[model samples]
Each structure stands twice: as structure tokens, then as C-alpha cells.
Target: MARVLIIGASKGIGLETVQRALAAGHTVRAFARTPVRLVGADTSRLEVVKGNALKTEDVEAALDRVDVVIQTLGIGLGDMLGPVQLFSKSTRVLLPAMEAKRVRRLIAVTGFGAGDSKSSISFLQYIPFRLVFGRAYDDKDIQEKLIKASSLDWTIARPGILTNGHRLGTYRVLTEPQDWHNGTISRADVADFLVQQITDRSHVRKTPVLVY
Candidate 1:
């Protein structure tokens, strides 16, 4: 069992990833800005650390001895719509902390428009995303570029439109563009895919687009 650290585990994909890792008998250290209230979270194998990813001290303090680092750190509509600087600041802080701790393996989660797959999304969805979510996506672009340029073993998973549906465990992974359009994937499945890549390492230094 690997000792894993999941940043931004307060809710959503990060929370489910923590549960999945613990169920697989791995020791999981979950970091979040606020306290987590996950059901059936194994206290013995799960350690919750409250800290903001934008703070170097917080990240350094939470970086205990771990085999892999999975970052689900992101800003929602409020922060995303408000300012692009928020995302840049958070990512800037996280990279240095990981380097300082000598943590090599890093897996980060970003949405579809963040990478080369941006042009693959449908026009209907892409219209509003380009207008409203433009800044956020640009910030993600910068963040991804930094990760790609880093000397760490990192893989960025760019999941298509996220839904709260059941985890069918069946999805398509593509490194380059495909002919398919209008893809929707569950957040749970994305988390599962991220955990799988923790040790798989096949797509290291690559950004893969996931769709259901």
C-alpha cells in the first residue's frame, strides 16, 4: 500500500478519491482548507489536514512522508469568475512546496479547456465557456504550462463536462483530439482514473482528455 497525499479533499472528487484510496488499503493524508465530514472515512488510514494550497507554510506543513501527491486544488465559480490571479497564486504556492518536500510524483486535475483538448469541446458549450469562463481557463492554461515545464513526474488529467452521475467505470482516455463530441463524465470516475494513474505512470508528462 502506498502512502498518498491528496490536496483539496474537502468535498467532491477529492473526497471520493480519499475514500477510494482508503478502501484500497492505502494510507491517505487529505488536505483541505476547511474540516472534512466524510462518511465512513477510516480514521486509522485517513489523516485530515486543514490548510490552504495558496499558502506555502500550510502546504509544507501538510507534506508528510508520502509516495504520491494528487492535487485536486481548484476554485469554483465564485473565485474563478472573480479573478484569474487566484488560480495562479494557488498553483505557484503548491509547486514550490512539492519541490521543497522532494515529492516527485504529482497528479493534478484540470478541466477540458485547460489543455490542447480545448478545441475538442462542442461549440454550444464552448461559446459560454469562452466568454464567461475565459479567464479561469486561461489561468488553468498557465498553471498547466508550469506543471509541464517542471522537473517533477506529473500528469494532468483534463476531464470533460463533469456530472454527479454513478461511476460506470467505463470512459475513454485520449491524449490527442478525436472525432467524438459532447462528452460527459462523472466526477467519481475522474477521481478513480486519477488514483489509477498514481502508479500507472503511462501518461506521465502528458495531458489526457477523459470522456464517457
Candidate 2:
């Protein structure tokens, strides 16, 4: 099992990924400001480190002894309307640390409207995309550029609108521009895909729009 470092593990997709990794027997180092709540699990293999990823020292310290880094940093609408620095800022810290530690694998969740895939967002989803997710995704666009420029083996999983459904494992991994479009995918399934990317090279250095 790999020693996985999950940035922003207090809630959302990061929180779910923590449980997914632990259940698969991987040692999880959860980095966040608040503690991760785990029920009836092995704490020996789980380390909940309280720290903000925006702080350089906190992220640098968390990179220790980690095999795969899964970045699930996110922000609410209130923060998004003003400024969204979490994605680019935290990612800036991660790149050099991963390179320095010789850790090459990274799986980051960016969502469908991120990167060039923005062109593929269906008309039905475009209004909400622009009104709600525009700011956050703009930073994600920067985050993607940074990751692509790096030499690390990275897979950017751009899942469609995230829900709290069970992991179906049948989520489609759409790679081509023609295939990219608006859809829905569960946080659990996205976590499943992120865990698989730790050792799988099928989508390495590639961003696929994951959906059901």
C-alpha cells in the first residue's frame, strides 16, 4: 500500500478520499485545518495533520514519506466571489515538494469546467457554470497549467458535478475533446478513480472528464 498524502482532507472530496484510501489498506496522511473524523478505522495508519495548505511550511511538512499526493482543495461560493487562491497557491507549494522528494505521482480533482474542457461544457450547464463555478475554475485553469509544465507523473481527474452517491466504479473516463460534455459523477467514484491513479499509468499526465 502507498503512503498517500491527501491535501484538504477535512471535508468534501478530500474527506471521502481519506476513507477510500484507508479501506484499501493505504496509509493516509490527511492535511487540513480541522481534524478528519474516521469511524471504526485503524488510526495507526492514519495521521490527521492540522494545517492549512495555503501555508508553505504546512504543505512542505506534509509531503514527508508520502507516495501519492491527491489534491482536493476547494472553496465555497462566498470565498469564490471574492478570491480563489487555494488551487494555484497550494499547487505551487506541492510541485517543488513532490519534485524534491522524488515523488512523481499526483492525482488532483479539478472538475469538468477546468482547463480546455471548458469548451465542452454543454449549453444546459453553461449558465450555472459561469454564474457559480467560474471563479474557482479560473484558478483551476492555472493549476492545470502548472501541473502540465511539471515533470511529475500526474493525472488530472476532471469529474462532472459531484454528488454523494455510492461508488459505482463504472464511471466513464472521457479523454477526447469530442467526448467531453456536461454530466454528473459521485464524489465516491471520483475518489475511487484518484486511488487507482496512484499506480495506474493509463491516464498519467492526462486530464479526463469523469462521468457516469
Candidate 3:
């Protein structure tokens, strides 16, 4: 089993990924700003590290001996559009740490509207995104570029609007840039896909757009 390091494993998709990884028999090192909430986690094969992803030293310390690094760190609409510094700053810290520690496999989560998928979104969905989430998407685009340029073996999974639905154990994965057209996929499925990357490595160096 791979020794996985999941950044932002406090809740949502990140938390689900941790659960799936453990069930798959992989050792996990979960990093989050708050560690207490992870008290209920399966400690038998999990290591919870408390730290900010925006800090270099914190990320470096957490990356020690990590076999793979999966980042689900994201900003809300408010933070995303508030300051351009929000996205770049956090990514800046994490990328270098992984490089320094020789952690090559990096799987990061972005959304459908972020990169080359912009033209893939429908006009109706595009309108709201351009008007409201324009800035955030812009910053995420930059983040994706940085990851692509890095020497690390990276796969940026761009999911259409995420949902809390059940994990049906089935979903669509696209290697080419395509719009999800307001499509939705359960967060549990996203977690399953992320954990599967650790050992499967089928989608290495490719951005897979996922949807139900």
C-alpha cells in the first residue's frame, strides 16, 4: 500500500478520500488546520498533521516520507474573488514543499470552469460563472498552469459541480478538455477516484474531467 498524504483532509471530499484510502489498506497522513475533529478517524493507519497549507514550513514538514500528495484545498466564492493572492499563495507554498521532499505524484482538485474547459461549459452556466466566479476561475487557471509546468508527476482532476449524493461507484472520466455542462458527481465518487490514483496510476500526467 502507498503512503498517502492528503492535504485539507478535515472535511468534505478530502475527508472522504482519507476514509477510502484507509479502507483500501493504504497508510495515510492527513494534514489539516484542525486535528481534533479527526479524532474519530481510523488511527490504526492514519496520521493527522495539523498545519496551514499556506505555510511553507508546515507543508514541508508534512511531506516527509510521503509517497503521494493529494490536495483538495479550495477557496469559497468569497475568498476566491476577494484577493488574487488567495489561490497563488497557497499553491506556491505546497508545490515547492512537494518538490523538495521528492514527492512526485501530485493529484490536485480543480473545477470544470478553471482551465481549458472554459469553452466546454454551456452559455447558461458560463454566464453566471463569468459574472460571479470569474476572478476565482482566473486564479485557478493560473494554479493549474503552475502544476503543469512543475516537474512533479501531476494529474488535476476537474469535476463538474460537486454533490453530496451517494457513491454509485460509477462515473465518467474524460482526458480531453470538455465542459461538464452543469453536470454533478457525488463527492464520495471523487474521493474514490483520487484514492484509486495512488496505486492504479492509469491517469498519470493527465487531467481527467469527472462527472456522473
Candidate 4:
């Protein structure tokens, strides 16, 4: 079991990963601004650290002695309309911190529309997606580039439309560019993949799309 530091551990896939990682027997440092929001998290192997992801000092402090880092950072819907920089800004802080701390493995959650996956968006969903998610995905593009350009052993998990469904423990890991497309996946299932990556390096240095 590794000491896994999960960024953005309060809600969504981050919270789900926190739970799943603990259940998997990994020591978890749940890092977030409002980490108390992680209600019912197992305290035995869980170290809840409240800090801002975009802060260099905060991220460096959180990276201490961790074997792997899983970044699931996100912003609220209210901020989606404006120019979004959370993903890129946080990555800018996180990557160097990980390298400095010698945490070589990183499994980051970037959605389907990020990086080359943007080209996989169907024509039908393009207009609305661009209208609503363009700003956010644009920053994710930067985030992907930054991660790719790093020296860390990284696997970028790009799940499609997110849901609050249960973890089925079975999902597709689409590694080929031709297989990349939009679909729906539960946050729990995505976290299942993230926790698995703590020791499973089969997907390292690849950005695979996840779906049911």
C-alpha cells in the first residue's frame, strides 16, 4: 500500500477516490481547501489536509513522502462561464512540487474533451460543448500538455460525462485514439481506476479514455 496524496479531495471523483483508496489500504492524504467536507472518510489511514492546490507551498507540503499523486482538481459550475485557469494553474504548482519531492507517479483526472480527445467530440455535441465547456476544456488542454511535458510517470484518465452512479469495478480503458469518444461513466468507477493506478503502471505515460 502506497501513501497516495489526492488533490481536490472534497467532492466528485476526488472524494470517491479518497474513499476507494482508503478501502484499498493505501494511506491517503486528502488535500483540499474544504477537506472537512469529506464527511465519513476513514480516519485510520486518512490524513485530511486542508490547503489550496494553486498554492506552491501548500502543494509542496502535501507532497511529502508520498509514493504516488492523483490529481482530480475541478472548479464549480458557477465559474465555468468565465475564463477558467484552475486546472492549468494548479498543475503549474503541482508538477514541480512532485518532481522536487521525488514522487514519480501521477494519475490525473482530465475529462474527455481535454488534449487530443477534443478532436473526438461528436459533431452533434460540439456546439453545446464548446459553448458551455470550451473555457474549462481549454485549460485542461494546457494541463494535459504540462503533464505530458513532465518527467513523472503519468497516466491521464479522461472519463466522459460524469455520473453519481456506483462502481461496477468493470469499465473500458480506451488507449487508442480511434477508440476515444464521448460516453457516460460513474465517478466511483473512475476512482476505481485511479486507486488501481497507485500500483498498476500498465497505463503509465498514456492518456486513456474511460467509459462503461
Best by TM-score: 4
Q: Which candidate number would show the highest lDDT if scored against the true structure?
A: 4
lDDT, candidate 1, equals 0.82
Q: What is candidate 3's lDDT per residue for 1-212, written digit by digit as tens?
A: 89999988988889888888888899999898976254355779988899988888899999999899999876566765565555667788888888888999999998888888888888777788888878877888988988988998888898888899878888998876533444789988999999889877789888888887
Which of 3 and 4 is ahead in TM-score?
4
**Which residue runs does candidate 4 get wrong by more than 4 Å?**
37-41
Residues 132-156 of candidate 2 have per-residue lDDT tens digits of 8888999999999999999998999
Q: TM-scores across all candidates?
A: 0.93, 0.96, 0.92, 0.97
TM-score of 4: 0.97
lDDT of 4 at 13: 95
For candidate 4, the lDDT comes to 0.92
Which pairs of residues collide in model 2? none
Q: How accurate is candidate 3 locally (lDDT)?
A: 0.84
Query: In order, what lDDT does every prediction score?
Result: 0.82, 0.89, 0.84, 0.92
Ranking by lDDT: 4, 2, 3, 1
User: How accurate locally is residue 26 in candidate 4, as Cα lDDT from 0 to 100?
Assistant: 92
The full ranking of all candidates by TM-score, starting with the best, is 4, 2, 1, 3
Question: Per-prediction RMSD in angstroms?
Answer: 1.6, 1.2, 1.9, 1.1
Pitting candidate 3 against candidate 4, the one with the higher lDDT is 4
